[model samples]
Target: MSDAKLQSVLSSLSQVARQLEAVPSGRPAPDASCVKLNTNENPFPLPTIIMQSAIAALERQYLYPEDDNISLREAAANAYGVSNDQVIAGNGSSELLGLIYRAFLAPGDSVAMMSPGFSFNRKLAMSQGAQFLEIGWGEAHSLPIEQLLSGPAKDAKFILLANPNNPTGTFVPVADIERLLAQSDRLIVLDEAYVDFAPDNGLRLIDHYSNLLVLRTFSKSYAAAGVRVGFGFGHPEIIGRLRNIQNVFNMNVIGHAVGISVLAHRAAYAENHKHIKHERQRVTLALLQLGFSVIPSHANFLLAHVPAEQDGSWWQAALERQKILVAFFPDKGLQNHIRISIGTKEQMDAFLAAARDISGSLKMPSARRWAASGSASALRGR
Candidate 1:
């Protein structure tokens, strides 16, 4: 516990350990009375069958879980029309992403991703001692295809792409993905975390490209995040390697049962997603009418650029006071924007009402600071 010993231990720590900062602790779970919109949790409820299955699973907890999640893998394969060997289950899509780095990344190996991407992609890469490459988002908030196809990017082990990308919720079309595929031989990880809310998925292109890996979760669309189950579809070769780093019992019994139930009851989940998509559009339109240039989204959220008259920091605080929570990015470019998770129509109505009520007296973050942010001008211009 002495300073000298502490310094030595710190020096020996991995780069990821040194770079990783603790998350600002907040409430363990959402306040029961709060309109929780900060995290992109599905505001819908799981079917009664899932609940019953979880309770039933309690009796089996005395036994070891079915290791390697074979049933769930086969179910995912059936859902995606792929062979069973081409799939593997994880505690979450996040752990699968970690498995990629643990399995493939050597000291200098690199993973390419977009600026303002899922932050965990960069964190996971660095933590695994791999280099992380970032290309800026292009016009219309599209992926910078040219940069990704450039010679430098070709050397990366893979590119982490979130179709219906987080925060922005912009999707890269199948044609666009094909363009990337044709130009580069590197592996492409299409993280379709929000694809359930989108028009198309990357799974259709799997037949054409041997280098594609598509990951999906039971969290966002299926409303089973608490279960922490996720899976990936890829060429058997790549999936086999990911399997090597995976723990035998990565997916628990409850997660296995819940995942199977969700796959079987896809229609019920779809119906709820349809409602979320509608709410997304409604909120987007309402924000636009209020002078915010809301980005077009294919996911269950909206990235609305704050008006020149109000700052996201201010709106975030104001909303918090009103028992509403939403995600805010304070980095140079994202400072003036707010990302709102689409909630039930009633929750959204309250949000819109709060915006209108607070508009008159809301004091925004400083204009000078906004002017200093390159993201500010670029996003506003869009």
Candidate 2:
């Protein structure tokens, strides 16, 4: 193929086709023997009911899944007090994100998103031939509520807000979002992927705001990442529109059955959820005491900003040398941070031990940043 011919062929491709790239870090699954905290996956075993249900569904694999998403959808609706019409299911939250772009974003339309957030959102916008206006947060890691309500972001067709956001693991409060909604007309996408571990969530606000759409996934909390179940809630009109664009058979037989089983017996998993919350507290304190600039997180991960003097890449390389993996970012805003997922207490203890060994110091760094700056308490007295 001549260079000009190849260039022409590429130019003929759709914007999405031309811009799509391989997934960065590609979902962070660590080795089984490795104390895996790289992915924000539930470190516990699947509930017995979910296990039995998925296994039983194996017999039905000979046939296509019933488009009957009823049981799972209804379980989610009942959990959030919405009617089934107000809900839609997807292969994962990523698919639902694409569906939202498909429904609302015209080619070249703009979106508003934050830097150091779920970077996947930026890629999603690019894939849909949409542009994004970014609002970057500093070390303080405050939500850009005032900025989002300002002129720069007011005209976007939609906005992607990841609460208990990814990578940075910071949160925008529910009341703050309510205030933003009153001032803005753009569709607000509240990605609550990690909200299961947070103190508050967006499930209850869907009934109040016509433009708000909240997305959830079984990947992180339900211990069903392998089953690929994700869903969205909103005003019926928006959900109905997403339904029109979604594949009727988007979910598979085994995954459908598994999702139904998981949501139906959600209470059974509460203990693991509580354990993660507790461990997150312990991990944050450990990081803080070590002089790592930790952003207090409400998600299943913590974003520990390595001091500029210490070098994040070096720390990551050191951990990898010890066969422990974590999510590392080369993006400028997050280049100095590594996202540590909340794992079993044993796994967390292993991580702290590895981190200490890597540091090679008997005395840890003082909380110079947190104390002198008056930012906030780590976990002590909170």
Candidate 3:
């Protein structure tokens, strides 16, 4: 190929490279050196049984993983009380999101998602040359079901709703979801990646709504994010379409083995879920006691609104200096807020101490900025 021709092809990737480069490298390391609260991973280690199963798969390193990953699929199906044909596993929930977009979205086809939501959905839609419609979910971060149900864009090709949405940790009620499902003719991709931490799950609604597709990951509650195992449940026909576009061997042998083992021994994962939920509530109350406005969350993370004048730049830097890391987004709607993932109680105590210290050091000018910015209204509860 001529040099000009190669340059023309590579030019399209420049935007992608810039986007990736723009991601902040503020996360704490996972080793003993860092407090590590940036990523929403489980602080606890995987159960002994899962570790054993993964080790056993090591003995069969020479062989390729099963093409169908039937055993893993069966386990997931049973866990969700669905037929095996309805379950489709992937490297992680992130991969499954990409697969669904590629399988269903065509150039110019529109995908509607809530704004200030997970950044992945927007990026994925754009990558496929699809029109991404981001409607701002109200300050509470709940889906604008009424607007979506009656809007001109109701017929969009796909709608991705994150139950107990990431970062904000807000969720739409089941009744609201039912309304959306009843009115939506297009596919509704309900991302339940953090559903295990929510008090209620959307799995029961799957059989009732053929247009609904629920995606889940073993990362949070199962402590398997590193293993990269995730799955989706939907109508068998939709599952078939996804399978057609999927890689032949999406789940590796060890991932499949560990996934199955984790599902088989649910007690440990269940206990972890309970512990995280309890901690989430405790942390929410503690933040509130500290005078920070917190969005009520049903997920593993809490989005607490900090003072805008508090020098978010300095606040984040100070936390890092104290070895406490949390997530900060640039969206104006989330600028004064920090998303903290729930870890052990001891970890949370340390995080609280860091926040207290930082709050004490913030100048009055910063406090005035926060007051002028309507921080209270931004985090008003439902």
Candidate 4:
């Protein structure tokens, strides 16, 4: 094939990639010498026992992983109080989402999701040629469940609810979710990636609601983001359909072994959960005292509003200079806000100090240059 023909084939493969490349990288400012809080990761390292278990699996390096990953599935099923047949594990919850989409979404089928939610859901829906019906979460970052059920778009085939939503950290109560389940006919996919840190979890409702699928990840609570182990529970029929669409060797040997070890030492993971819950509250309080308007959160991060004059682009740029990174979005309603992941107490102290320093310097004329330079327009156009 000619070079131009190859280029055309690759271009047709993904137009979203072209659009993504045109936008400026919106990553939190990198920290060369400061505490990192951009990603919502556990500040504490994984326990020694878990590492040893993963190392033990390496001894069987010559053998391929088990086709069904039966041991890991059984452990996960026991942990969630479900039958092994109802559980499906994947490289991450991200892959689980893809499997579910592949199983259920035909081209032109519609999926409903909340706006200002996780960007991955929107991307995944569009990639499948599925129409995304986004319901905008207002100032509170709460899912408009009633509007979703009662709106003209009630014919949506699938709905994704990110409890303790990303970039906003707002949660929908179990009562509200039950209400939604009672009223809607759509398959509800609840992304419970952050539920380990929340006061309540959705595992209990899986058996009661046939249409509900709850996704959990070891990345958040198990402190194994690098290992890439995630599982979802639902009706056995739904899980079986997803399993049919997944690759044969989806779970690597090391990850499956580590997952079993983590399940066995559930108490240690519980302790880590207690520590994170405590620190999350402490960080929220500190940000509130600093005069930043913080959205109520039950997760390991906080969504806070900085000054709103020229959106939050100015504050984002200032933090980059201090090597204190946090997530910021330039969407219409969220333009004045940034999301800060809760880290160790020491890390939180450093972030607060950096925030004070940045606020103090904002009065200077030179500090206002980025805001004046049309960064808002640049962001919007993208």
Candidate 5:
């Protein structure tokens, strides 16, 4: 098409859509041999019963999945101790987050989230022509209740808080969350994607606060990232509105079957959860010993400040050279930090070995030159 025709066609798009450029196709996925510790995924296999359920579901490939995910929602309701009407199932909690943005945010409205939180919300808000406000966490990464209540966030359509927050892996106390819920009239969307790895959760607050919506996913803790099962629990009215706008047959048969089966046998993954926590601690200590400052993590990942000699990207690139993949954030205040998802013992061991090798190579040249110049001898004599 001519530029004139393309311009005319583009003019027909909404202002928001017109303002947003088409996303570029990114690079191909990493090599299979690379140790992937970038995205926080549970590197474990599904229990035998759950695998059997997924195989059974494949046999029904010709049939449509349950409408509105009724059976799966019922299973989640029973498992989480909520009424069926108060639940809404989605392909993933990410889908539910999109629904919340659609249902609550109009053009020119605003939403607030705890800063250094999930960065995806900014894109979601922009797609709706809504303002995205980022509120910083208080000292020690605690909830800044007064700031959230009295700051510009006071007028936001809703507040988004991720317990055991992403990128930082810092968890806020449930009592502090309850305090905020009690004072705020705005809808509070609590993303608990990593809660199973944390000590406490805010699910109980849903009963008392009509404004609280808790989101959970089977992707992280349940080792079903490929299956894409997630849920939202809130007041029946809120859930109903989200469900009304959700896509028809949003999830497939395998997702539905695996979701129900997992809920029924959640206890089966106790060892999986325990192993991640163990690895998280082990990695944290190892990073500290290597001259990286690691924040105490409650989630299945750790955020570490790289050594003073190099930035996070440098470390990330060096690790990639060793075929170990980890996450690096370029956002302000995060440029010096890298996040690593806790994987199995073998993966963590490989990552640690790579990190140590990188650290050693960095120090070797300086040590060699200084020693050759007799600087070390002079310092020792002094």
Candidate 6:
């Protein structure tokens, strides 16, 4: 097309669409040999029975998945002790989050979330041209109930709280959440993606509070990230609205089968959950001994402040050189912190060794810039 035609096509885009730049191509997947602790992925295999169910789903490849994911929803309902109408199944909880944003928000509306929570919600709010309010955690990462109830968040269409919040992994008590729900009429989205690792959960609150909506995923504790199974449980009215707007066949046959099978065999993952918790504790202690301050966590990951001599970016680059990959955030107040997912014993050991090496070598007068190609500095264009 000519330049004029291209310009005409672009001019037709909405203001919100135009404001957001297209995503640039990203680097290739990390080398398999690298110890990946960046994303909080439970690097374990499914139970034998669960794998068989997934394989069995192949026989239905020609047919579309169950409409509205009925069977899967039923399985989740049964597993979680809720009615079918109270549950909404999705490709992942992220999909349900998008549906909620669309169902409730319009241009100029506002939404709120616990600060340093999931970053994806910010993009979701932006796409809808809604104001995204980030309320900070109270003392000791507690829930700032009064602030959320009376402050700017009081007027938002909805509020999002992640138990054992992402990037921090600090859990707020269920009582605090219940108190918030009791005092506020606004819809509360409780993301329990890491709740299986936490001490308590707020699912029971849904029985009493119509405003409560709790989300769950099999990705973390159940080791099903690649399969994309997530659920939202709330009052039948709210769940029905989200279900009505959800796309047909959002999940594939394998996801449906695996979801149902996993629900039935949740007890089978007891040892896996135990292992992850063990590793989380072990790594936390190890990081503390290495002079890093790790926030107490109730999730499968740890967010630790890097040593005073170097920032998280420097540690990330140094660890990459050792073939150990962990997460680093450039968001405000997180510049010096790195998040590490708890992996197998061997992976944690390798990471600890690499961390020790980097910690010991921090004798330089200042944080040195890594100049190699694909270094964090290079990748971040610093």
Provide the RMSD of all predictions against the true structure, rounded to 1 decimal.
5.2, 7.0, 5.6, 4.2, 4.8, 2.8
**What lDDT score goes with residue 297 in model 5?**
93
Q: How many backbone clashes does candidate 6 have?
A: 0
For model 5, the local distance difference test gives 0.92
Candidate with the greatest lDDT versus the true structure:
5
Candidates in descending lDDT order = 5, 6, 1, 3, 2, 4
| lDDT score, candidate 2, position 364 | 30
Clashing pairs in 6: none
Please give the RMSD of candidate 2 to the true structure.
Answer: 7.0
TM-score of 4: 0.88
Q: Which 10-residue span in candidate 1 carries the lowest summed lDDT? A: 373-382
Root-mean-square deviation of Cα positions for candidate 4 versus the true structure, in angstroms: 4.2
Per-residue lDDT for 195-269 in model 3, tens only?
Answer: 877767788888999999999998887889899999999999998889888998887888989899988897877
Q: Write the per-residue lDDT of candidate 1 for residues 1-382, one digit (tens) a residue.
A: 9999988988898776777666797748766898888778888778898778888887798877887788888988898788899898989898898898788788778888877778877778877778888777888877677888874677898888889898889987788888987777889999999999999988877777889989988788888888898888888899998997788788778988888888887887767888998999889888888878898999888888888855787678767767889889876678888899988889999889877655533333446434433234312222
lDDT of 4 by residue, 1-382 (tens): 9999977976886554444433467887544786667778777787999899999999987888888778888999998789998899989899999887778887788888877777777777776778888778744565577787888447777888888788778787788888788788878888999987777777788888988999998887888888889998999999888888889989788989889998998688777788777877887777777668888877788888875354566666667667787877776778888888888778888888888765655444653634644343323211
lDDT of model 4, residue 358: 58
- Candidate 5, residues 62-179, lDDT tens digits: the string is 9999998999999999999999999999998899999999999999999999999899898999999998999999999999999999999999999999998998999998999999
What's the residue-level lDDT of 96 in candidate 1?
93
Model 3 TM-score (2 dp): 0.87
lDDT of each: 0.82, 0.81, 0.81, 0.79, 0.92, 0.91
